[model samples]
Target chain A: MSFITGKNLSCIRGMKYVYGKVDFTVDAGEILVVVGKNGCGKTSLLKTIAGFLKPSSGQITISCADDLQSLDIIHYIGTSSSLKKQLTVRENLTFWSKMLDSDADNIDKAIKSFGLDEMSNSQISYLSSGQIKRCSLARLLLAERKIWILDEPETALDNDSLNRFIDIVTNHVKNNGIAIIASHRPDIWPDNKKLLEIG
Target chain B: MGAFLAILMRDLRSDLRNRAQFVMIPVFYILAVILFPLGIGPETGTLSLIAPGILVVSSLFASLLALEKLFSSDISDGSFESIILCPVPISVIMAGKITAHWILTGLPLALITPFLAIMLGLSFEIALFSSLIILLITIILSLIGAMIASLVINTGKGSVLLALLSFPLFIPVLIFAAGAIDLAIIGGIGNSIAPILFLCSLTSIALPVVPIICAAIIKWQVR
Candidate 1:
């Protein structure tokens, strides 16, 4: 089993401290929902664990059976869709598949699971914001990374898409994936998740 | 290798789909070159004398047109964050991007140079040789531009800032490339070989180093 542990995690942005003395642990098949008010450094905390930002103090470590480094196992998805508007949905996913050296079969699986099969050939520019978000999330399945560092992944998603997303994350956890989600609506996630509140 | 090629093809395909932006650089290059001859009175001797400088300077500006968005689009759209987090080395990704930029902006500038040179009254042999030198210089420009583009990705007026930061880096290459072509036109191919070799050496050095610098800068920007 794999797990992530953050001990007294404090982050600083510029001269100001973002969040201080935050501690949390998330094992395989569990979700860590980070919640707080606006400007609570929720994004900064997630980015810190995702390796995008340096922690001013404390340490965050990932322990897994595999020999892969912490970066190799983490899949960090920020607020932006990160898809090319000029390319079709399939084209974007295919590019990620090759870039990550993932199994080609996962592309079709991801498209189907994310309900993107119907618009698979449509350019990203033509898709709705919710649809674009789905395309970006489909990337998580394109590779078998163990940790999912998601920041407000439900922002533009509609109700049906949101339900679908929760299902996907549930399924991912069921399959032994770790999801560290930063969301304002933590109720959407199932119970049995650790809540870390920061501001 | 797979990641590099994937990024390259993805960029190429994206540029192909947006043909307007793809065509703008070469069109800009041609227009810039055409203006020089018109303003200089079309005197063959004057045109020939200034052709090397004209081609190099225009190509430099034309190449700059695309460098502004080289990494900014990716950064703004979030593709860069995703790409950087991938298992492949960031240098590989940067190489792919630089190659794509060169193909879209630099390669066209180099390819069309010979015709522009001949139009400015240089011999076919000299034009052919000058195009090769221009090609090498364009490669180096793309490398330098990619590095600077990544550095200024988060700054306001990035295009202007990019040009400012990259111009000094580009000047040395510009001097050598134009000097080689001028030498070729004035004293024949043999006299231009030294500067040509110098351009080649510059490209070889920049090819491996620029990408690493770009990767590091990009990482820093996101941080």
Candidate 2:
């Protein structure tokens, strides 16, 4: 059974439209790449599936490890860096860790895994573009939710960091977690990952 | 219960870390009160005449200054999305943020009003009474301001819109707060306490209801 399923989903923002009756499903223990040009509703689709944006019309169901309960089964990381600039890297992680109801012990591990130990005390505003993105990715990693909806997670990262990000995604999928990444970069795509392209 | 405490602590920590904004509210309050002496001559009678109104109005602006930052940053950075996704209800989350805002802005301004009143030539009894009344009214105004702030989060020039939207709701509190001080100055503590108590009751009712309304508006805006 699919971890996330959406039927006839559509979203409109003012005069500029993003979605049009899009249908997709993501299964557990699998990676799904959503490839599309700029302004192709890729981000909106991720948001709708993650329960951030309500669909103008259609049905979305997310199944978690425990059970199915409407659409409350996913953690969404949007294109914007969600880290509070005024907060240190550690503080930002702690805030989200608590919000996601995750184990506090894993926060340190997640920071180290993201290569953010040295910058842990640094406020997010002082971090470089890549560091800020890492902070946001760390929050996503720290969340206990099973389904991940990441929008353009590859933007503003160096080649090495991109490889590290892909590794994180692979590990998450290997652990029976599902991820739907909206990106245009082909190099990050794994061999077994399914591609859903939107024009 | 845990989620509420977590949000409140997080917000308070953020507010303290950004000390400049927190410090500016009281500084503005003091400065605004000081200006009355400059404009109307520093006579004890004249300063006492306007002290209560000045105190309440200054407290109102101080609370309003921090209202926009309450939810806008969270909304923009996607932290608000994470919050809404929590298993705890949205009303609880909204209440947490509003309560934190009151403690940081409204509570401080309320505490300092007695010192401010002395400077403005109020008698000791009148000063203490005015401070207590302002504290009660400020909490209510802060909650109402928060509700309006959440409603106008997506609007153009949200802070200005919030002030305009909430100012009318604040008029009654202003009237009662100032009236109570006026009564205290004339040795009518008994008369003043009733109005102040009534204002506090109004605040208690608004505390729970306003956040629920604000949460609904936020949900609608997100949709």
Candidate 3:
């Protein structure tokens, strides 16, 4: 019973309109992929929806079953990974899990879900970009958020890592979690996911 | 409460891991305090006379030194956005952060300033009293620093802008702290209470309000 609806949503960044009058809807147990050309406002739209950027003129509505603030239920991932290079993979993940302020049990589950068993002890600075991406993605599973607004989550991910990620999202969706992903790789995404294209 | 504790621990741990970043502030404070005596001649009378004002002013500058980095690293690394997304209010998170910052810079400076006061020819008793005064001043300055740090975190000219914004704002703390220390140096402990109590009032007001205002400014500017 969780859903996000946008009516007449328009986004402006520094006097330039990224998108205008775009409408979309996403519901529980669904994956909404935003596809668009470069600089055409895919990231802008996601940021606006995630509350990072305020909409210039529009209304983005959220309806949730548990009566929580829409922002509290969302996890936004931008292009830059929030991983600290000085800390080990486990350290970084543990820090994020603590910040998410959820059950500590999910910490172990997130580590396993990201397939980070071997590299858990390695410092993030030493890990490959793909491994780092996986660590960042693990944060989503660690915190139980209803909506995940991700910006280009596929960058630097390998095929195996991508599969693991897809499996994690699939499991999340099965549990009524929502994911709003902006990616250019349609081939990597599941075939049945909904698409929202911005010009 | 959970977010606040988590942030406080994280900040303390992060600072502990990178100890040099914080160590430099106190070192600079000592060095700055030592320089005044040499530049103006080491006459005990002159040194003791200016000690209260110089120490207070120098401490104010020391607080400004690190304010720029308070949120810049988190912002550049994208950790701040995560902090902002925490379920608790942003001001609470800032309270934790500002507390951690005070522990590192202001607390240490207060402890060491008594020793610095000795260089000014002040007696050990007044030095201890002056340290107490410094503790209060630093707390108020830390709160003001936290608010101004949020204001300038995103701008390019951060340190200069911080100095510009904070120098005028900190005038009252500097005046009261110097007044308290000067009174202690001249008229003994009893005479300094008025300014010290005034500082306490300022801190009491800033303790609750500054963080909320900082959070609001952060929310408005972060986008």
Candidate 4:
């Protein structure tokens, strides 16, 4: 397992200073929930950490004995659903799995586990918001990554869907994977999770 | 190779299923070409004189229409971020996306150019030759335009900025391609072949270089 550390992390987006001189660390087998009010740069913090946004001044170092770079082991999901609307749910899963270098059999497993088998062939545009959220999160199961960065993943999910979402993240963390979730509701997080509140 | 094919296949499926975006490229090229003869008198000599240049420029602008969405839609929908997180090199993924854009707009423009050329009063041999040049020219323009689009995708007025940034880079390739097609119109293998080879060499170099630069810019800007 690697130690993911951000030293003196300062991020600026456009003219606004998102965060200044912050530091945090996460080892394998843990979940860190980022909680804050609207417009508090929670998403920006996760994005900067995901390599989507460059920090104004800081360094994120992923340390391990292996020669692998940090990006090789991260799966970053943003606020919006990443599925293509025109393609069927199954097609979106298949394509992303293929892109992520996962095998075909796993696609079916993810579909079945996420309870999307019945609507697998339906186009994403036709699915409801909760269904779309499920389809989006189902993609996580298709690939294996050491670091998972999810931004507001509970957007439109119903209570049942939210439980399934929590279960999935808990299982991943239990298996020695690291997850950093940015959401407004930290109370919903599973037990034994770390909390980082920012404004 | 797997990552490249995965992006290509995914885009191919998306473009095939919802075709209004790509269909506009060839349709716009045809519409723009038709306006030239209508706007000018239908005189054979004058129309023939302008036909090759007309085809190249119309296709260039048509390619611009497609390039804006080449990165913006993915960027908005969060798929672009997922792509970055993949283990595969972002450059190879970008190359695949650019190639898919070419297949949709460039390849179709190439296949349709001969008809537009003949309609503009070019001869059978001349139209056939110019179509091949237009095909290569379209591919080259898409590569250049895609690079610019990647840079300006998140800006306030990105489409306008993309055009402003990419058009200057496009002018040189446009001049060479139009010149080659006009040389073909002048009817000689010796003079025309050299320019055609030069144009091909340009496309070949751009094939690798443009996507790699676009990928690097995209990665840097994400931060």
Clashing pairs in 2: none
Model 2's lDDT to the true fold? Answer: 0.82
The candidate that achieves the highest DockQ relative to the unseen native structure: 1
User: Candidate 3, residues A1-199: lDDT per residue as tens digits?
Assistant: 2388888988878788788888888889889999989999998888787777878988777875333223678898887788777678877777778777778888788889889999998878788988888888888877788888888998999888888888878888878888899999866777768899888
Candidate with best TM-score: 1
Q: Give candidate 4 misplaced runs (Cα > 4 Å).
A: A57-59, A65-70
For residue B73, model 4's alpha carbon misses the true position, in angstroms, by 0.9
Candidate 1 chain A worst ten-residue window by lDDT: A62-71
lDDT of 4 by residue, B1-223 (tens): 9889988888888887787886878899999999999999899899999997899899889888888888876877888778777768888989889888889878999999989999989998888888888888988888889889888987879878988998899998888888988887776545688778888898889988988899898876665
Q: How much lDDT does each candidate structure score?
A: 0.89, 0.82, 0.84, 0.85
Instruction: Give the Cα-based TM-score of candidate 4 against the true structure.
Output: 0.94
Indicate the docking level reached by candidate 1: medium
TM-score of each: 0.96, 0.94, 0.94, 0.94
**A1-199: candidate 2 lDDT, tens digit per residue:** 5767878888887876787878888788888898888888998888777666777888777654343223455777787787778889999888777777788987898898889999999998899999899888887667666788888888899988888889988888888888898988855777888888776
- Worst 10-residue lDDT window for candidate 3 chain B reads B79-88
TM-score of 2: 0.94
DockQ for each candidate? Answer: 0.76, 0.58, 0.56, 0.71
i-RMS of candidate 2: 1.9
Chain B global fold similarity (TM-score) for predicted model 2 against the true chain B: 0.96
Tell me the tens digit of each residue's lDDT in model 1 across A1-199: 2388889989878798789999888899999999999888999998888878778999877775333222678888998888899999999999989978899999999999899999999999999988999999999999998889999999888999899999989988999989999999999998988899997
Candidate 2, DockQ score (0 to 1): 0.58
Query: How many Å off is the CA of A122 in candidate 2?
Result: 1.7
Tens-digit per-residue lDDT, B73-96, candidate 2: 878877777666666678878888
List the TM values for chain B, per candidate. 0.98, 0.96, 0.96, 0.96
